[model samples]
Target: MQRDRNQIIQAENSLLASYAVRQDETGVREYPEAEHPYRIPLQRDRDRVVHSSAFKRLQYKTQVFVYSVGENYRNRLTHTLEVAGISRTMATALGLNSLLAETIALAHDLGHTPFGHAGQDMLSDLMKDFGGFEHNKQSLRIVTFLETRYPSFPGLNLCGETIKGMMKHGGEYLGSHLGQERKEEGPSLEAQCADVADEIAYTSHDIDDGLEMGYLKLEELSDLHLWSDSFLKVKEEYPDLGGKVLVRSVIRELTNGMVSNMIRTIESRIHQWKISSRADLNFHFQEGKRIATYEPEYWEKVRELKSFLYRTLYRHPSVVVTSDRGRDIIESLFYHFRKQPDSIPETYRQRFETEGLERCVCDFVAGMTDRYAEEMAQSIGFKSKEA
Candidate 1:
């Protein structure tokens, strides 16, 4: 027996919470199309995001360490997968739309530039006189305007709900250019899950990467309450465990603790806010109350951990050197393309007539991976290849 789209949606609705965004409630897109027989709208949207060219480019983009740093370090693609896995787990535990959460997680970093945050910061500074650059807005641009998968539409033309989830994945909406209706309220619970999942995945994985790369010693993190508590528990269980095994166990425990706390806190918030339905969630959101969050105490700990990572791992001399080099490459590429607009591919060149030279150049440079950006910089004589 083959269950059609409606049947699948019905099953999904039955399993999800009242406050979860239903497939039937999605807004219409710029290009309307028929739904697939076997796939729900959100599922199709997830597939479209997975298949996008920008999604593929994520494999080579940096999460912290550049691609040339080592194959074992987390790149954008691995980070996206980690976020998706964590998001789906939280969404399922919270009785929200797991597929939407996963889709948003997968698409959230689709706009990240070549050397992680460093590349993004440089690009933003370069484009400051223009419209400025933000990865969230760039991710939206990739799905809505840049990706050319369909002959009928300019982009993937994903469901409105999925796009909404992506726009609000960071717990805030910055797509004011998307018009008034898209700026109605805070993100849905699914988007909230994805946002927290991003935080969890990066916080845990960056520590793992730092430890492996020798930038962060295990003893150094022993002082942080979150790490100390998790480390104590893991050590209790595996007394003989040391090295990578011990580190991995502690990271696992830390992530698990955070996810469990987030779920518990959100459940309490839902009850406190009287949010029994999606409408109620939206009402509370529009009223300037957030229904999804970690407990205040735990959130403070997370902030402390983040500060530690920023000082120790992110600002470590080796990482700083790479980031500085990456910034130089991005700046060089931006100026090179800005001067010789025709040097860019015809596809981007055509966009210059509509988006202006700087904006078009920004788009072209932003889409490049670490290796591509470095190679382009060398080719343009902006820097030596060995440099």
Candidate 2:
């Protein structure tokens, strides 16, 4: 005997907390369609995101290092997967909708430009007059108007909740593209899980990548409370641990510790706020209360770690040079297509009439992988031998 969609949804909802968004509230798509026979809306949304071209292109998009930096470094795709996994664990532990959390995590970075933040910063600077570039908003644009798979819909036609979460991912919601209905409710706990998962994934993995690249050393991280605490615990557990294996274990422990801390914090907050239902959560948000957070001291430590990474790893001379080259490639490509609109693909050129030439070009360039961007740059005589 197999359970149908209705039965499955009931069974799943039975386990969720009152504050969790119900599967039924996955909300409507921009374009209406028949529901799947077995899959709930959030699950269906996750499948659609997985199948999107933007998700696939994350393979070649940068996270912290250029794709050419090393095969071992985390690319955008890997980071997204890590975030999704962590979010599922956290959401499930908190009795929230794990599928919704995972879906948001997977789709969160869909709009990241090639070459990571470097590409995005350059694009933002160039588009300042037209409308500024934000990866979060770009992601919303991709799902809403850019992707052209369905005959009737221009974008993925994702659930309104998913779209809202994307825009709310990094506080980029400016009431520009989405309607008031979608923007009224604050971010769900599932969305909060994705946000924290993203931070945990990047912080831990950057440590791993930084160590691997010889850009960061264990000795340097000793002063950071998060690292130092996790390191000591790992060392105490495995006194004989040494070298790469030890470092990997420490990173794993760090990630685990952060997830556990978040779980505890959320649980504490729920009880303290007396949040028993969706309405309660919404009321809290309306009152300017936020749920997803670390304890004050822990958050300060996390902030300290972030500051350390920004100064020591992200701004390292080698990483900066590599990121600079990527910026140059994007800059050259942007101007090249702007000067010669015909140079962009015929599909994008068609969008120029409605989307405007600058936006159309921005979309085309934003969707490029590091490798493809370099190829486009080389075609126009922008030369660079470095990664």
lDDT of 2 by residue, 1-387 (tens): 888899889999999999998888787787899888888888888988899999999999999998887799999999999999999999999999999999999999999998999999999999999988999878888888787778878889899778776666235455544545445677788888899899999999998999999999889999889999999999999999999999999899999989999999999999999999978887787778778888889999999999999999999999999899989898889999999998789999987888799999999999999999988888899976563
lDDT of 2: 0.89
TM-score of each: 0.95, 0.96
lDDT of 2 at 297: 93
lDDT of 1 by residue, 106-215 (tens): 99998989999999999999999998899988998898889988988997787777777777533344444333444665577898899889989999999999989999
Candidate 1's C-alpha runs over 4 A off are 169-179, 384-387
The C-alpha lDDT values of all candidates are 0.87, 0.89
Error of 1 at 364 (Å): 0.6
Best by TM-score: 2
